[model samples]
Target: MSGATILMLVVGAIAIAAAARRYNLPSPLVLVVAGLALSFVPQIPNIELNPDLVLFGVLPPLLFNASLDSSYLNLRANVRAVALLSVGLVLFTTVVVGAVAFWVMGPSLGWPLALVLGAVVSPPDAVATTAIARNLKLPRKSLTILGGESLLNDATALTAYRVALLAAVGSGVSVVHGFALFGMAVGVGVAVGLILGAAAAWLLCKLSDSLVEVAIFLILPFGAYALAEHFEGSGVLAVVTAGILIGRKMPKMHYATRLQGGSVTATIDFVLETLVFGLIGLQLPSIIASVHDRSAAQVTLLVIAVTLTVLIARIVWMFPATYGPRKFSKRIRERDPAPSKAVIGVLAWAGMRGVVTLAAAYALPLTMDNGQELKGRDLVLLCAFVVVIATLLLQGLTLPWLIRRINLPVDEDQADALAEAQAAQQAAQAAVDRLEEIAEAELPTGSTIVDDLRTSAESRANAAWERLGPQDESRLETPSELYRRLRRDMLHQERTVYIQERDSGRIDDEVLRRVQRELDLEEAMLDR
Candidate 1:
């Protein structure tokens, strides 16, 4: 594509994403629909979907950002569920979907080709799942499991896809050998990711500038992915591992760095996700053009059958994977309470596939080992596209409504507020202790500053505790709340004076800005 076309696509995608957000619609669904519609316009250029770009360029940062934001502690607590869905379910879906595709398509496609199609559509898209789940405010554990599964499942699916693709092209490997390869890829990928993550963290700590720190993180994902792929490892896993590691280490870095890094990643994620889903839709014309020697009825039947197989397989596997362990193992039953049937139903429906499916399908080589055209390659691509669309449209669109209908027990916002209040009280007490200790050692024994600082710290702690207290309409302002309001008003007055001084040429712009920044910080502390 030309530079002009790329610019237009980016602008168009941003516009569509903004519109989607404004209307309370999912951006991925909107982007895909828009791209599909735009593909038919004669004036628009045919933008080819490059598999290399999607896999290497797009997948790494997207995975890295998601993993970085994921709770490492939560993931560890829920490791069993995540592993079941990410690794076990992905492999099972690949086999079940492949078998169903083989049965529907008949002998001409062969087992290898059918399996290839299955592998392509096996993993749900982390980007799509995280985006929708975050917006819908699903249960905390469900969100964690879904997010964690999405992060890791791509590596499993892509590795399986590669193995299946090799077999399809006559460079076949035995089942035992394929499993060994998969193991090696995961092990090596994790090692590479850890090394890269540690090195990046060390560098980030050394850099005081927030912008530079953010820039380093921007490069970290792609570098880790490329390095791991060069060493015959799974790039997707490598990126994810690095992200989680670095995210855990972020608290040790400067607060400004964390703030800046968060903003940068959010922007990057929005742009890349919009472009990727839109690109998925843009490939519709090519997919349609490539369907040769098959009747429309045959194609329609194959798409429907394969799509249903994918959905049903997830539901079948999830129920057993979810409750079976608790039912059989006394330890599991005592340790982890079983989820309700409604929660399980939501989990089953949340397995919507996305861009990774399309990228893997498009990555298939054009020919086999004997130089004959690869059988059913285009058909596989079409089937994969259909599955992505079907799951995203059917599952993504309905998931929010399902969650509302189920009315799960957890209230995420209330839980978050309580947790925040507890943490704040502890932090405030620590600050007060440290302040008194410093005052005793380095200042006059009866310093007024120490008393003032202690009072402020106590007020802050009391304010946090107030959040958990019952609200009374008659008694609107507690002592802590009144303190905060007065402080905020004082800061606002100071800010007004600073602006007036600057406007009247009594203070330089630089001096005014520095003073205003200090007031802003003070106001921010009161708000916090």
Candidate 2:
């Protein structure tokens, strides 16, 4: 790609990324739409960047960020289900797809080559899965399984793809050798990740500077990926492992350093998420260039085949797997209740394919083992793109509606509100305890005076919490309503000031944006 073409693509990608966030749409969808529009324009100069760069470079940071934000405790508790879905389901899909493709398309492509296509589409995208799950608020077990499985499934499928490719290239694959490589890949990746995570954690703990800490956090994902690849391990797995480890270790680390007057880790996550989505969208031009000249019939067939295989494979495998486990667990534990069949159906439909599939398809080799140019590489890329679009748009948009239809139980923010009230009561009690210490030292030596004052303060805080519970206390009796009203008024005042500053020529647009963001954040904390 020319420098000018690259520059234009980057600029276009930024605009699309900002628009996607503003409109509350999936950023990748925005990127694809934008890319499709740009492609039809005359003289755009087709962009050609390395597929490896898009997969490893654009992907690891995104995956690491997803893993870091995931709940470690939830993942640990649901390890069995996650493993069954991630490893077992990925392998099963590959087998089913390989068999079907080989049986149906073997005349056009050899058996081994067909298998490679299957491997490419086996793992769902981490980015798409997490983005959808963020809105669903499924059970902790289900969410953890989905999130954890997405993180690890890519490494497994990619490793399998590499092995299958090597076999096709006459490298003479052995089961023993394959197992050995898999072990080494996981082991070296875990070791490197832990070492890097420890070092990063130590540095962040020691440093009081927010910008420096955020910078260090940014470097760690790429560093882990590069180091693992250098050692012949799965770089993707290493980045994920390091993220999980570091995230678990971070709560104890004082992330108190102010970055634009906010927690450093939170700032880092925001910057990384925005940039990653932007980059994912930016990859559109190159992906389109992979498919330049295909007949309409050929294109339609490829898209239909890929979409059918991906959608069917998930439903066929997941229904059995989800139910089998629930039954087995019930048998083993005696009191474990099975997930309702309706809930399982919702989980099955929730499997949205995304960036990882597109990345893998784009990463396909230009030439095959016999040195003849790969006939269907473009078709594969196009098919993968179709799968991503179909799953993300169709499933993502419909999932919330499906959940409501199923009538699966969920708290709908009431639980969170109650927890926040409980926590506030505890904090207020501690504050009262500290005040008592001060009062004892400074008071005029009247015991009843101090006791009465402390009791009254405790009663007010407890009353707020009591209103949150199942009690029938009148709303007027709860001081929380007053606090809530006061907070709302304060937030309104801040919002008005922000608008005034933006309207006046006193502050630049960017400064006004920053100030407005602060106001929004303060407004958000009013609930807590």
Candidate 3:
């Protein structure tokens, strides 16, 4: 595509997202619908999703950003559930869906291509799930499981896709051989990811430059992915691993680096999400255009069948995967009681296909190893596209409604508030002790300075505790809240003066920025 077209696409997706927010609809739905409609316009080009660009160029960052936001501790806590969804359920869905597709499409489609289609649509998309789920007020554990599953499931799905592709190209892969390939991918991918993650963590710590540190994080995901894939391992897993590791260390990095990295990551995430979903929509026209020889009825039958298989397979897999452990193991019951059926219902319905499905469908080679055209490649692509849209429309649109109507338990905001208050109190006490120790050691701790410092720490702790109190607007403004309000006004004045000085040529832009940043940090602490 031309530069003009790319610019238009970005602008259009942003517009769609804005409109989606205005109307309280999901951005993914709006983007896909807009792209599908635009695809039919006579002036538009036949923009296809390039498999190599998406898998190599686009996918790594998307997965990396999601992993960065994910809590390593939370993922570890829910590892069992995530594993059931990501690894076990994905493989099961691939076989069940593959069996159905082959049985329906018959020998013409063949087992290998049939399984390839299955693998293509097997996992719920990380981008889609994260995009939609985070907005809704699901339980914390539910969010963790969904985020963790989406992060790792691509590894299982892609590995299956790779194995199936080998079979399709007549590489003579058997059940035993496929399992061996999977084990190798997991082992190698994890190793590469850890080695790269450790190197990145070290570099980030050693480097003090915020720009350079942020740049390292930005490049690390792509490099890890490429390196892992070069060794015939899963790139998705490698990128995710590196991102999670780096994210955990972000808090320890320089504040400037944290702020810069966060801002850059959020911007990239918004732009990429909008373009990708819209691109998926633009695909419908090309998918339809490719089915020249297949009869309309046959195409219709296969699309519905495959789409149903994808939808139903998730529901079938999730309920058993959820409750089976609790029923069989007494320890499991005590440790993790079963969630309400309503939560499980929502989980089952959250199975939307996206990036991997779209890229994997297009990634198929034109011909097998023996040089014959890869039969059913067109149908596979068609069915995969149908499944993607069908799930997005059906599940994405209704998810909010289902969640609201089900009255799912929300995260413990009150408990979280209490924890914050406790932590602040303890930290304040620690600070006070350190100050006394410094004063006793004959540091520049004047009586007035020490008193002011102690008072500031106490005020911060009081602000946190106030949140857990009554929140009536009629309540009088506490000293802490009043102090914050007064401090914000002071910060504004300080920034105004700095800008005025810069405008009058009394100070350079650098000086203005330095002063403004100091004021900004001080102002930020008030809110905390």
| Residue lDDT tens for model 2, 37-119 | 65566765555445575566667777777777778887876777778777887878776777766665555656566666777
Tell me the spans in candidate 3 whose CA falls farther than 4 Å from its real position.
22-24, 443-446, 471-473, 476-479, 504-507, 524-528
Error of 2 at 444 (Å): 9.3
Candidate 1, residues 1-528: lDDT per residue as tens digits?
677876788888999999999998899989888988998998777777888888888889999999889999999989999999999999998998889888878887899999888889989899789877888766889889999999999999989987888899989699998988898889989999999999998988888999889988899999999988888799988999999999998899988898778879999999998888888788888888899667888788889989998999999999999999998999999988998888889999998888888888888999999899997988898999899888888898899888888788887777777888889889998998899788878999888888898987787666776777647757878777887899888888888888999999999999998998788767776776
For every candidate in turn, the CA RMSD to the true structure comes to: 2.4, 5.1, 2.0
C-alpha TM-score for every candidate: 0.93, 0.80, 0.95
> Evaluated with lDDT, which candidate comes out highest?
3
lDDT comparing candidate 3 with the true structure: 0.89
| Strongest candidate by TM-score | 3
- TM-score of candidate 2 to 2 decimals: 0.80
Overall local distance difference test of candidate 2: 0.71
A best-first ranking of the candidates according to their lDDT comes to 3, 1, 2
lDDT of 3 by residue, 364-472 (tens): 9999999999999998899889999999889998999999998987858888889999999999999999989987787674678889889988987878888786477
TM-score of predicted structure 1: 0.93
Count of clashes in candidate 1: 0
